[model samples]
Target: MAESEEELKNLLMKVKEESAKYGLKRNIKKTKIMATGPITSWQIEGDEMEAVRDFTFLGSMITADGDSSHEIKRRLLLGRRAMTCLDSILRSRDVTLPTKVCIVKAMAFPVVMYGSESWTIKKADRRRIYAFELWCWRRLLRIPWTARRSNASILKEISPECSLEGQIVKLRLQYFGHLMRREDSLEKTLMLGKMEGTRRRGRQRTRWLDSVFWVTSMSLTKLREVVEDRGAWRALVHGVTKSRTRLTTIFTIFKEDMSHILSIYLSANAFQHSVVPVQLVTHKQGFRVTLIEQEHEWGGTSACMEEHGLGIWDAHQNAYAVHRNTAWRDRSLTSWMCSCMPTPLVPPASAMCTEDWCGSP
Candidate 1:
């Protein structure tokens, strides 16, 4: 832990020096330490007395009710409200609500500057994963639409949909804020593009693109070809900026990536029900592939290969073991590297029966 802290301090110091060149200053106190696990809201029962007692206990623990009694009270109030808000959120069909909240909480450092806003975790020990997520959501709720999109990196890592949703929200905010000149509006309209794609096979993954071109060219087949072109990938992201339709189109690609990764389990005929965390790693030097096999009953093995073109059949067999390729394609047939061998390590115990149970991060 000491070595880790020292390493972090050195990394931060380096970042500070680098930022000085751009006249941008970073306050370490405002930075968030990355956390692992997911978040969920527990069902609160036992009526009003139980709620008040729960609130009082949490309030007393975080605050002494002295010189900063008001601050303490405020945190308690915020926690209560977050709990209530979480309850309302639970009523919805979305399971990612807690995770979205966690992202916002993780960004609390920036939101605090907005004033009068605060957050606190009650019964954090009960479920740190969901609690942290809720903390994020509360902070996000308080962020102005325009400013929210500024944290694109954080949004992509946390909730891509919310990040894209925020981009749309920002446009509406700017238009209403009187900051949208006619040219600015036109520019915004033209910028409506999706922010996701598939990695190129024998490359990383593949994503669908070209909705903007489709809209402009009025040709569906041409649009799909252009979007899937590996050479134009970076250019496409720069072109589209504000359209929800474009964003949805991109999200569809993102979902496609998830679907491809998850398909491994379905093909293997292993545990029919399982949630596997997928990671797509790209190296600057060149493409490398390594597969880790786990022994959990509920868990299953995964096979991934880089492919180009949106279609799975277009991928080259050289990218992955021929026996493993199910629905993926490869870009460079000669450059394919397969890491389909199972790891020697053993998997952890069986996962909890409930889908809400978050395994090791």
Candidate 2:
């Protein structure tokens, strides 16, 4: 956002430090910066003549992957490391700036499309393609100086013990992998269906189907901001509605799963060691459902008593009187799992139907 050379240098230095921590080195000679122009850019060196370029400083996409050597893999890993750093820095800002990194063209590692290629044939070499794509759209859209200031302020709000590097690594493994998995599954499924009548019948192969829900890696606060913001929320709802027909079948599948999940229990300690009862038995005979909390933090609201409990009316616990007494009750949970134990059963409003939350006794 800010075009200052010093600011850019400092940010790049931070990225370089992160790369070295990951046992990867950055080659600055391949690095280039376009401070002012039709398009701003940041380029960093890669292994075997590979280089990563952030198009217009909006995003960094991987390039130069023709070599199948270990060195090339190391460079790709560095590219990912750089991306993780950028994401953390961007999230620290209150106002997100959108960024897009386009990998110009390069050799792709066979590992990306693992298990799909036939072992009978020799691997192709030197194809011009983007190995990976990284989008930092939120960071690009923000005002630079404001973004930096907000980031600085956010550091004070967070714990010094909470390592940003650790966070980046976790986010990369958790969310980015999920996103890629979903995208790859969808692409493969479409391609597989079309291969029946296509010329490349031999290339047809099995791929996993996309799951119904993929958790957003963004923090709860960020998620709440996006989902609650009128503009962003409206757009999301509208888009979902437009795709409702395609998702209808998926929704039915989800409802089936929801009906099967009967109980929920969550607990956490000072060290954040947590336990969540995944599956809860229902009151009905032979019916048991699993509970999946979309929310990351499932601790109760009480600051003094950190321990919390939740249960649905199930065959095992329903007969117990202790399950019947609880401060909060979700009437809609009559059909599924709930926070309270057995209660005066009634169908509550759809929104009121408890899914997952934490609160005091």
Candidate 3:
């Protein structure tokens, strides 16, 4: 840590001297030191630079802790502003909701997702992202906060539906995949570069590469493999961001394993008393459940029922469940719904789950 500080100080001092030689002046008052590690304040020349917890550089906000939550929050606020700026058109009956949503996405989504490709996202960050998304959608739909409708109800009217997180993931994965393809480039080396040091107190925050694993559902070894074929990767990303049903299904299966879906399918098949076998298949979009419509002993010609679309968000008693029953079932037949709700922000765990969980920096 001391060595790191000396190196930084030497570089800054050299910069100051170089500025003097060029007849340029250094403003110590405006300049602030934002250290990442244990070394706090340091002297540039004779003036002592005070360490700051947060600072902005080239429009990107950075915290001493190196987490993106603060930046994400700021981006969301900017997105809200963008949405508000177009309030007249979005709320205007002169335009259709589809056009309004397109305008919002084209105009405001970029603001919301600025620099998201580099974010080391945490669950708190996800909650904030979804919260802002919900706010934007609610404004677009003119749904009051006091209304008792759920996300499922609101999703029905959303034309060309998509998700905030899913898009961010797609963008990030695409960016990473691009970089990974250019193995001989300096950017690739710098991006994949690592520094050796024992971490400070608590668990380490998720790095860009670590977060990409969750986004792509690939291990470290396979990251390069997935990026080899740019067309395939692009199609994969498109499938994720282009369809809201696929996005929801991704989140659904991401939360639970395919075994859970298999169990449900098995239970359904057994309950129907059908001799026909049921098969569970996984795809990029989601699970494909295929089963005989009826047993030959109980029916004539062979028939089949398959459920391939996204599931439905159903509320029974007091809890909620996403249903994926076959198309033959009327209630949840191939339904696609968003179960987005405000997830309670919890203190980050010391150990991060290798799957989808992330830690605060």
TM-score of each: 0.18, 0.20, 0.65
lDDT by residue (94-134, candidate 1, tens digit) is: 64655645533433322221221122212232133223333
- lDDT tens digits, residues 1-361, model 3? 2347778777777788899998998888887777777656767658977788898887889897777888998999899999999888987999987888888889989998888888888868876876677688888998999998766456456733457777787788788888888749876886788878877899877887877765455786777776788887886676545432311211222222446532121111011122333222233234332322222122211222122111222221111121222222334323322233222112124312343322111
Q: Which run of 10 residues does model 2 get worst, by summed lDDT?
A: 244-253
In candidate 3, which residue ranges exceed 4 Å CA deviation?
1-3, 184-204, 242-361
Supply the global lDDT for candidate 1.
0.31
Q: Which of the two candidates, 1 or 2, achieves a greater lDDT against the reference?
A: 2
Which candidate, 2 or 3, has the higher lDDT? 3
RMSD of each: 22.9, 21.3, 13.7
* Model 2 alpha-carbon miss at residue 350, Å: 24
After superposition, which runs of candidate 1 have C-alpha atoms over 4 Å from their true positions?
Answer: 1-161, 164-169, 172-178, 182-361
Candidate 2's C-alpha runs over 4 A off are: 1-54, 58-273, 276-280, 283-286, 290-308, 311-361
| Candidate No. with top TM-score | 3
Per residue, candidate 2 scores C-alpha lDDT tens digits across 1-361 of: 3457467667877888899998987765665554334433443333122223232221223223212233333434554555555554445555322222221111122222222121111112111111222111223333343454432233233212222222222332333233333546653354235434546557632222211121132553454456445575444333322221100000001223455433232211012222354433233333333332112132333332233333322322221111222333555334443334333333223312233333312
Span of 10 residues, lowest total lDDT, candidate 3: 263-272
